[model samples]
Target: MTNPLGIVGAGIGGLTLACALEQQNIPFTLYEQAESFEALGYGIQVSPNVVRVLAALGLTEKLEAIAHRCYGFELRSFTSDQTLIKWQLPKNQLYYQCRRADLHQLLFDGLRDKSKLNFATRLTGYSQTTDKVALKFEHAPKVEVAGLVGADGVGSPTRRQLMLDSQQTKPSYAGYAAFRAILPWRSPYEELAGRATVWLGKNHHVVAYPNGNLNHGEQWLNLVLVVKESQWQEEGWTIEVDKSQVAAEFQNQSRLLNQILKDMIASPEPCYKWGLFTRPALPFWSQNKVTLLGDAAHPMVPFQAQGAAMSIEDAYVLAQCLQRHQTTEGAFQQYENLRYQRATRMQITSRKNADIFHASGLKAIARDFVFKIVDAIAPNLMNLKSAWIYDYDVTKL
Candidate 1:
């Protein structure tokens, strides 16, 4: 029998890719560094672009049970406390808001061969021959497989080994970080039920939405507060910090902002902070029988909320490419060809949104004015502009 493909890192992207491959009867061995899967991460938006992918995997009904089906988006001015743009989706279009752990569990349950999972196996590096690739793990035996995939995330060792000299592999601080919390929902906030609200401020922005419960009985609300920082070199998502740090950053902002921060502080939950980082899109992501997917290939800032969506999209497409092409090299080439351009565009656009969302003074005024003009003249204009993002269906490609 042919050897199973080696998937490094069991993140959402890796697990999604594995589940896709399993559907096609493709064999794979999934390696995770952690000893066991724990409920990590605050919340994530499963945008319309990726909802189709989940449906294809026969996971839509399960997702619906545990996710809040968001109906639309609202962009508001932080200084003025005024709604700038409000747009809703058609009934057919589906957008979900849920805890990242819940989404991760959903994908994990979708996988058939749980026995293929490996734990406490930290990938150190890898080397590839003409036909097979060997994955090196810390204090563990090197395993050889027909192909290798790097879904190990931003600090991916697989990505490091694949492109040693490429400048794109290095990540630079994006001058900001996010303070995230998942607060239990006792009641609904204004426009936060079944909708995502973006509070745009000078050098900062806040996104809040209802996150469906994780069998904890009470519903939850997810909050991500992005603030500009002069110096913060660390990059991680699960670093716990005091809520006072978040309060100090936005103390001079709006009253609503203060209230939100107060509620976060009052809640028993802890706030986690992670520095935002970005890397240039790689001109190539695969070499020989080894390749990359998700943040391992292209890491982006969260300004556009497409970071996870892009990875999920990459997972399905890469699985398709591998199933179609007989040779691993051929499959890697086709996957890169189909994904590079679109993923690069997302990276660039996401960076641009950072500037747009954090506009100041006259630029902020102009930004609000443009959205107001579009809202009044053509309310549907926002929906029309985001069509390219939400309308993507990877199954059609």
Candidate 2:
């Protein structure tokens, strides 16, 4: 307990782990490569499962104050221009769509001592022993700790280093990329602000929802346009786009979809883009006192919308086991045992959704027919899938 636990990456998973450890009075240090945290990215949905963890950390009040509570989730058809299906969100205890930075800040400020965070100190290398481990960074001297965690994200250096002892690994691209726009929420768009809508098409889908935290006082609809691609050579989370180029891609879809895309294009903001990536479930999640968390363990395509939620779940469960088990190995083993099956299932489900969402020809026809019948017979059938995800409370793990 004397040596502070070393955590690499200050992302949602890393931040959540740090906060959970602090709540349990465990000393820890969080390292981030970024010089300073900036507000980037678009809307993120904090579903019921994740909110339970935040509520445990005493962040419910702050979170509810900033995020928009989701009223319902509707999936619409782009070809037919009709509502394919809908699920009414539970009363007041529904899902929330918060700006990514807003949630990060909530966890960031929850730390008791700001000095515990070391920014601009990237992980360069690491070595471990039975007693403790040493962490090397790009900008500073090495530090040793009882345990080391890789919450750095998909390209986690900690994961790569651990992989040296086992199977070689790398993040694989999904041959598709997403373009995002924060359209100004005003006048005509005002009425659609709070609803979470998904427009399903032949080879793509669009997810749109309003977030009130774009500019100082302005509101904006966060639209994510996901389409198939041949190749992407981008290096970062966002990129510049020729408005006409984006428009041309979606011109074949519905008129409503086109109008929304056009308005988003007219906005002054440059479109943010990132390639969707996927990876096989790791052979394992732990090696000695070093282990993985979040995307580092199981990176998946974003079809399930559980990327962040699963990470939040991992953070809580990891901290819980680490607090109880006497040895780091036992703690990590239990953590994986509790999570591996469920996490793998989620990856499979999310990946399968891509095929379903992007269906064409005979596949698309059968998919629509099945959905129509389900909507007629059991309207709430699709909503039940959420209980497996949203109903989980990691604090009780």
Candidate 3:
């Protein structure tokens, strides 16, 4: 199709979509609110599901060089300091934990030269006639296109303009805060092999994993601490926080974990925090020539670690839908039909995992018991259970 497709947000979802559409010989333009395509933040888990999508885009070699392959996730009890579950990951499936910047670069670099990726071009408003959509930008010239994609994330301007109903569900605070930081590898922990680890405690949890290429000496370790809180001010993930404050929150944690936090807090850089938020399921993902993708369509808790994965899935499926259908609207409806249920299920599952991960009192003990039994009976159960998610091949769909 020669009709130009416009995408807002150059995030994982938007960039991936741009690349996929390009590969399919589709014409498109990508607008990013950021000033430049600079890498941001600490680390993210790219499960086999996401890896499969990246591989389809021919990014395997570049990504593999920078990502740490984790065999599985180990869950431990914070109070007892005992291993509760050691769920073996998928056998043939490889999971990578890489710096967010490195992943972003891989996607950004993959876009075709013809793909117009305009930075600092924020979406201000948009209007649609019977045949085309006209997009207005904050600092750039307006453009008319066959379709507009709202890959702009949870605070999507397209969503706001399209679904203006006062009753529409807004993203609410999830009553928890997460602090993520990257520390230089040092000594014992440095020598320790790359693996993902989760320490679960009452009302909080800590997840750590090796990030960056293993060949680049010892890789940097990424740490994320989620704690229940009464108030959260920031709504976006990039909001800044005091490192000392974050350190204080985890001071009562295990000594070993506390040491890690101290090192993170002592870093010269400011720590960031954001209140996780999600919208109630929208009845549909599209209207006219406009549609949502990634966090724009479905935002989920990070407990499942599938936020980026879902967006990757959306990117591939959306391109497929457009390729298979005659009109933009038809393609959108088909995309929603194929994606809504899966995204909603993932959102619910992530929420459920949050409850389990943050269990307190007797509930925490029960959770530990279940983990032990499951680990003993089926060492690979965790990996097996997520097979339906991780093993999915979107290209074949």
- TM-scores for candidates 1 onward, in order: 0.96, 0.95, 0.95
For model 2, the stretches where C-alpha displacement exceeds 4 angstroms are: 165-168, 213-218, 252-255
In the order shown, the candidates' Cα RMSDs to the true structure are 1.8, 2.1, 1.8
Q: Point out where model 1 deviates above 4 Å.
A: 165-168, 188-190, 213-217, 234-238, 252-256
Q: What is the lDDT of residue 79 in candidate 2?
A: 73
Model 1 TM-score, all chains together = 0.96
Whole-model lDDT per candidate: 0.86, 0.82, 0.83
Per-residue alpha-carbon lDDT of candidate 3 for residues 1-397, written as tens digits (9 for 90 to 100): 4468889999889989999998887778888988888866688999888888888989999888888888877888877658898865756987899898888888888986733988889999999987889999999898898899999988888887878743574566777888778888655465234578888988888888888887774478888889988787654566777888887776654666777877887766567777787767887879989999999889888998999889999999999898888788888889989999999999999988889999998899898998999988986877767887888888888
Q: Residue-wise lDDT of candidate 1 within 1-397, one digit each (tens)?
A: 1788999888899999989999999989999999987656779999998999999999998888889889898898877778898888877799998989889999999988899889889998888888788888996799999999999998888888888856756877888888899787754365478789899989889998988843444478899999888778554555788898787777644566677788899999999888888898876899999898999899999988898898899999999998899998999899999989989999999999998999999999999999999888877777877888999899888
Per-residue C-alpha lDDT of model 2 across residues 251-354, encoded as one tens digit per residue: 65466667777887788877767899888888898988888999998888888889988888999999999899888788888988988888888999989999
Q: After superposition, how far is residue 377 of candidate 3 from its true place, in Å?
A: 2.6
Q: Which of 1 and 3 is ahead in TM-score?
A: 1
Provide the lowest-lDDT 10-residue window in model 3: 185-194
lDDT of 1 at 323: 87
The most accurate candidate by lDDT is 1
